[model samples]
Target: MSLTNKAERSLISHEEYEIVRLTHHPDIYDVAGEDLQATRKRLRDLQEKERTLAREKRRISRGKAEPRGGSFPGTQERPSQRKQVFAAAVKRLSREIDRRARIAARAPQAEIAERALAMRRENFNASHAAADTANEGMQVIASRRRRTTVHPGKVGRVSQRTKAAQARRDAKG
Candidate 1:
């Protein structure tokens, strides 16, 4: 919606298109119909329209991110053409499902976890900077069971545990 890609969130893809078509775009999911291509075109056209809108929305948004609604082109007219489009859509949908599953199984949990932590910190405190993302990063890494040095450069920021350091110095003083 609001360029969730920047937030490291998943974007709708072929699977979503399938679901949308099944629930909404019945003209595109007619398996036994003769107008397969027309359905596929409808699906592709919808996705293309959504992507174009999202790209434009992202480009236009400069401040707090906002969501953009995608507009769909009208439905297919010729039944034969629709069948052709749908046949292709089904084939692409199958391949995409398999591809997406493979990627889901190998998702980068560490980077995503780090980004989520950073986003949360930003949401809580507008002043939260890269330097303040350390402890949260560690928590993410630990939760995910990933082994890493947790170094500033590696984790993308420095730790902000000033209270602990201050207490140590005060005791010494």
Candidate 2:
């Protein structure tokens, strides 16, 4: 038999530190023996835990609580109530589609195309509304500035100069 140093022998025998260079089998304990009773107990315990966890998750997801009135988060309306909301939305959409189709059929081709373009832009209607409000606010501020200014003539001259400079920069580009 070959003799091994204390360090090498300890490493080879260690449960956690596997000697891959010595053997193809990484785990020496598995090659040595297995506790069937312990494995069966562990598997049964895991299965029981999984079943309990699944049941608890389902209960939580289903929202085990008293139903209170009117649209609240995590509370679903009944089928009839949902059908009413769906019907209203569908009716509104159909009305809009019919209105647009009528306009397209009656109007000139160019006018119809323009209307369609405008409707497509209206899809981001909220953003356009915000921009319009901002522009109106700026115009109000500008009018107030003009009213307060001591020299209205100088203000107009300065504005003309600024516009000419901007125009020159834009033309160069």
lDDT of each: 0.48, 0.42
Candidate 1 Cα misplacement greater than 4 A, ranges? 1-30, 63-173
Predicted structure with the largest lDDT when compared to the true one: 1
Candidate 2 residue 92 C-alpha distance from true site, Å? 0.6
Q: Which stretches of candidate 2 lie over 4 Å from their true place?
A: 1-73, 109-173
Give per-residue CA lDDT, model 2, range 1-173, as digits (tens): 22233432342224211222122223222432133233333433433544444454456568974344445323131323222322332343344445556776777987879987886565544333233464343211122344554676676897899999999999999
Best by TM-score: 1
- Which ten residues in a row are the worst by lDDT in model 1? 1-10
lDDT of 1: 0.48
